[model samples]
Target: MLKLFEIVEDKSPKDRIDELRKDIERYNYYYYTKNESLVSDIEFDKLLKELEELEKKYPEYKIENSPTNYVGATSLKESKFKKVVHKKPMLSLNNSYNITDVIAFTERVEKNIDSVQNELEYVLELKLDGASISVTYENGELLRAVTRGDGVEGEDVTENILAIESIPNFLKEAVSLEVRGEIVLPLSRFKTLNEERLELGEEIFANPRNAASGTLRQIDSEIVKERGLDAYFYFIVDAEQYGFKTHKESLEYLEKIGLKTTGVADLITDMSIMEKRIAFWEAEKENLDYETDGLVIKLNDITLWEEVGYTTKSPRWAIAYKFPAKQVTTELLGITWQVGRTGKVTPVAELKEVELSGSKVKRASLHNMDEIIRKDIRVGDRVFIEKAAEIIPQVVSSVKEVRTGAEKEVVVPTNCPVCNSVLEKEDGLVDLKCVNPSCPAIIQGSIEYFVSRDAMNISGFGSKIVERMLQLHYIKDITDIFELHQHKDELMTLDKMGEKSVEKLLGSIEKSKSRPYSKTLYALGIPFVGKFLGDVLAKKSKSIDVLASMSKEELLEIDGVGEKVAESVYNYFRDEKSLEIIQKLKSFGVNFGKVAEDKKDEVKVEGKFTGKTFLFTGKLQKFKREEIKDLIESLGGTNLSSVSKKLDYLIVGEDAGSKLKKAEELGTVKILTEDEFLELTKE
Candidate 1:
């Protein structure tokens, strides 16, 4: 935790270098072996730079096997994966997030090649945001597949590789060569897999990249096969052995031999043309099947690539042009407030139109009064805006340098922005909300919620339709949706709503009346009451009347129903508006008393697995990790996020890491394989 300044203050040059080397080594171990990082990449780079500088000044201290010599720490020790030394080190590319660094990269390339910028050919490829893998072939037949563990030695995952249908077992031409590529889970396939998992009552993957990485590491090849992973060969490890003169030729040859390559790779002679192509891809990246964070540009000519050489980690011939961070600096023109269905008023910063990521931005959320005060953000101030994960717009910080006295201070309103109703806050709540049940924002939000896919699931009903319905006064309360059939002629006259469309809309609304009890409960938009909880409540209630009659203490008796959730439900049912809505829904034949058939009792148990905690490490052969976790949770067991002395069981699988060592140290924690754990469950 020592700062660089504190460490180097009184130390000798050699001592400072040694300290840096040791510190970085420790960090690398934690990052690579423990799957945890204590320091940011920027901080690591600063230490590395200091070490490199000291070593350069005092040549004697330039020790071999220094952290500078290695690309990264590997994950090959004490695991099941076989090790494969790369034929040619799969060097990484130096990345640039801005045009200045890219221009400098081109300048460096031109200097090394002794040629004009336009004279050199560059092979530009989309940088797939997935795990890097090296596949070696023997006489056109499949041999081994290795992950890029540390650029030197890597873990062999041949069995897992074979599961990918896109990768040919044998190439068209008989040749022995090593090819390097990225393993990716296509976005569509990723979504489908998540949907399937959700249906099976399993945890869903966060992203396609993580899904692909997890799939590759899974011990069960059948699971991998069903998930549908893909690979795109980018480079022949030793290009000269394949008789390829240019990078473009090698890629073409890979495709010719029935090995897949990214279809987006382009060979360009002009730098400006390359820039334009990169710009085009950056803007349209959302449409790509697999995730790509950036573009990799390499010298097209093999001889030039060789001459350019490589640094300690990255090849000099290639550089990754990373997409600009979603953040952008713009002038804050004004501040506006928006009230959501939950009655939470959020401050939105209206900005001078600026391009961020791929879209033109004008407004971003300031979150709340605390955020506004903390940042001291004001109107007419130049503010830095970032799209949180390239989606929600957020104001990161404001530039105080440009803030003039003319800038107005932002004030949190005491009244609702839409309905002008007095704002009130709950005892333990941070958000100020309009307590009025008929608040415009609340009404709109409730209507939107009732018609959502997980609720009444009305087809052809969306944001635009809701807005139009509100505007036309077709429905005031959510219950008025049932009376929509009476306004058939009015709906038919509205824009984009003809007789056929109105009929379809009415049919969807009519069909929604028979939605299951759990879905109707969720559609009520009660605080802390999610679809899963709604299902639990519906299974327990069997009737809306029974649910309404239940006391707070009675509601709290249900498992996973915390005090806040129980109180919210109890209070909701006791409300006059809620009672009226329930009566109206009942009168309309909406299925509010019918519970869907499910194995709701399976997850509630007190036998063998009760109060037991399980931590899964490495990989499992018999079942996917998620499936095992689900099984543990279903049997009254908790899934531990990390290995500790408190862990009751550590499920060790293939390529187990530091968690295994920690469990061994703990001694009290029981370690079990997938089959052994299954046997224990049978008891």
Candidate 2:
């Protein structure tokens, strides 16, 4: 027989295995929820591998719900599911491309309902960019999980469902309920997994959604159980059985049952307020780890939901407000430097033909050297870009997962692409600047800026025509606008040009020559002179000549014209190149005086609610706080910086702040509802 200590030690292998199981689950919860890791990935992986190996060695040691099973089991092959006609149809949400679309949605909602007597509130939830799965629990016991197959019958995946630890095998409170959730991988995890695969010489997954779908559908349940996946439950089917009076309560109940619920779901009773919350989250969605494509808005009251319920394919009580996808990919064929209106060097990516956000995007702006380095973007990399919310085209990220080794890195230009002037990266700023104002790039950029809206507002002179003129050597700078008449014959020969078009273009150019001094100043495209400050400076000056001669101190006297703007103006006027251009422009009949009349300010005392933070939770009775925010801001006060002690008062709208209870505990001032807010403001 073995010695007693040795015999015990031999038997202790089972004991050590039990301890490892508990440790892995605990670490997983900590890492996933708190984002706090007690061990490195390698350390964690080593322990997990040990546990997995032990479980495989002794199948009896495997716990039903283990961290090793996060990938879940392979879904059943051709499994049958009883048809479940949804009590409510899983309606697809309406998508919005911009704020105008959102506004239109809100207007349609209000118009469909009683605008005054009943306040149409909308409960906002994030639209997850992942695979949607529905789970059913009978008498609080885990039963089945299925994909939303055409919102009817779905493949039975009960064996696979047992693998997700987050899905409760048995609910703490025994109540039969069914819930729908999205299984997704986080951005960080998706990137890390792809990186790991690259090192292992495996093909990369394009994105989290693709990876998640592929993982879930894997034929081997054991493999599915290996890759970590998470799910966020958002809704409860048959919510009435749970005694929930509102959709908000149903969500709260789901959260109580240990499901990951959306953080942004709020009970909005006021139409305008609901609209604003939807808008707020649309902007805030970018900050989250997981992608939310849009908002899932539902009517709050359960009774109202039932009454307005179920169309053939959608629920009348809810709608999804989708945010447009801003980031899209294209192959970067090459890099070229373009000088901006500010004389700052910009890297423009020449891309292989790709469509993005409904536009055929051929070239995208790299913004500056810093952006290029930060994204690690390359000339041949599959690049993702957005116009930065329709403002300016910008390369957002490099799709490293899709990169072919053939793709080359982008190298910053040592000189301007157009003028070949030396490029300088200044301290404290990310942009590379071309110091030569007379550099051909800046000259061309300035001319474009001159004809732009804030400048001479020239109607017909566009980028294509300007480029053609430059190529023809008919024009060199802003003064060249007036000189265009000398090249009518050459301009007519350009593509899409005829005598009629040339006449219209020449007429517009002639009209622009006599534009006001502010227009002329704007057309100069002085660095830092944006539309707003340009307006202020133009109004302050008697003429372009006077403004050009003014000192920095004098320029600072104008509102909105700060020191930076003053410096740019001063530098432009001081430059010999700029002086020559201005003299040339004047000789060509460019106007040099004020154009538009400034409107008078109507001042009123700030309202009582000024600077007070008002958090609306639950449902509200009457006005939407979105309209309220507009009213408050118009009265020269700011909406408070979230709910805190510094808040002057919390306007307790209906179903007001979950944070309100916490605010009360913290002794923050609370005002019940917007009615009280209106009364207080009246006084």
Candidate 3:
């Protein structure tokens, strides 16, 4: 995306080679030293390959320290950690994006060595997507840990590495050796870390790999420990010195020494079986707790590795079979500003349809105006988009290499797109908010959230029905839902609203009034007050009136209520509009806190699910996710946000992913199916 120079027909090969070298060096510095990826792997490889071809063509332009000849950029001159020279240069593996190249690599290995008497054995292991590090052990105790900086030298990260619980401080055996592996943050931990950063208005990491790398480079080891980093050892620096005859044997020895290997590898004699395994892993890797970009194919025989030696930057005995590209370039058509229920405005980019990672993505998130300006993205320009964590599609950068004069700058709007009210920007925050409480979009979103399943459990109040009701002037705020029975006869005359349907709708509204105080607090749609926080506030305050009467200092005294949340709740109750709506709801007989106290007495404290913590992952068939969570709560069970040792049961459904794997690995969680969960709920 960031080109070093402009392309022209008359540009000489010498000049182009120079440009490519500078560009690749800059990318390397960002990637290795700063833990930031300015361009996708595909783009970086494209530049490197072009430079490699040019350097090979014109020997006069070749340089000794070119990026094509190095594993990564050198450690920063101002690095905090001391530099350590690797005992053996940590070379990178040649990357192959297709199966054909992998097969050719094996053929090349065979051709390089003398005629083989038997079939060659190969080891296939998942290529971890994270930061590379080498660890040395002296007499089985950890001596030091270093990053893979410029292959020959690296910075010491022993303090941060020691924080990881998985990497053992002392090995099982007292032999001295250095092992190489990847330092990765689990996907589950990555998601939680990002969520926490987002709440604090900090820039979220693009993916788990970046998060892990950044955490590893932290000046304070306490921050690194809090992030939950993990490592998997795969390669011994010198296998023959350790009496390992085969690659598989080396892995086994590492595991025997109390080191964690990938735990997924296969020894195959047939190329076809290796290809099949690659295909299988391409799909299965999606369910893994850690991110893996592809599979690393290595010759099983450590004896042959010396004969089929190293290139300038990569090892000849192994090649990385990378998966299909997850990033693609497409034309940016336009940007649309969307207002969320919290009034924060976000920019959405409409792009030309492009297939990425097996799905057609036509739109991506621009995040905010600051991101648009930072990336220099413009309409009618080519932009790169990638699915972050294989979930949310987002604009990564703009391809300034192909920009034309027709491209126009993306302008920030001064007013709300839907309500035409002035937008407000808060200090120290990148987001612009619409402070107009009466804005149509805000009102609509609030009412919709008020009747959501996790909130009031009100049925027959889908988005369409809410929109239609608003259009007909039958509802203006959340209070109108409680007073809907007054317009029942008028509602019966509407389309598909015959007598029975109208009666059922009114009954649902009445039923919602009996929901617990925690649900009511969440349904208020206060910013930052999620279900967990809502529960905390409800238990501490006991009643909505008492909560409103409390000062900010008193609100801060409540457990789990941070400064931001306390400020928001304190301000919300003081607003005239919100107070007016609360009064109207009281007149309509909506439950505020009395019903919650009465219901607390009736809860099944001695139910079968009592004293247990539960979590549900993947898609359910019989009950909706929120419905099942509410059921668990009613039966005296707690719903956790993630998989941990505290969890008692993990309810899994179709296509269960990392949570299921993590729960199984913990070995203390009881995994249950949908039918099994239902059976437990029965009296």
TM-score of 1: 0.46
Candidate 3, residue 636: the lDDT equals: 73
TM-score preference between candidates 1 and 2, better one: 1
- Candidate 2: tens digits of C-alpha lDDT, residues 201-228: 4446666776676566554566556667
Q: Which tens-of-lDDT digit does each residue in 264-315 have in candidate 1? A: 7698876678778888999999888888989998888775554465654568
Off by over 4 Å in 2: 1-330, 390-393, 401-404, 486-499, 594-683
Backbone clash total for model 3 is 0
Per-model TM values vs. the true structure: 0.46, 0.41, 0.43
TM-score winner between 1 and 3, please give it: 1
- Cα-based lDDT for every prediction: 0.77, 0.65, 0.80
Please give the distance, in angstroms, between residue 305's alpha carbon in candidate 2 and its true position after superposition.
Answer: 39
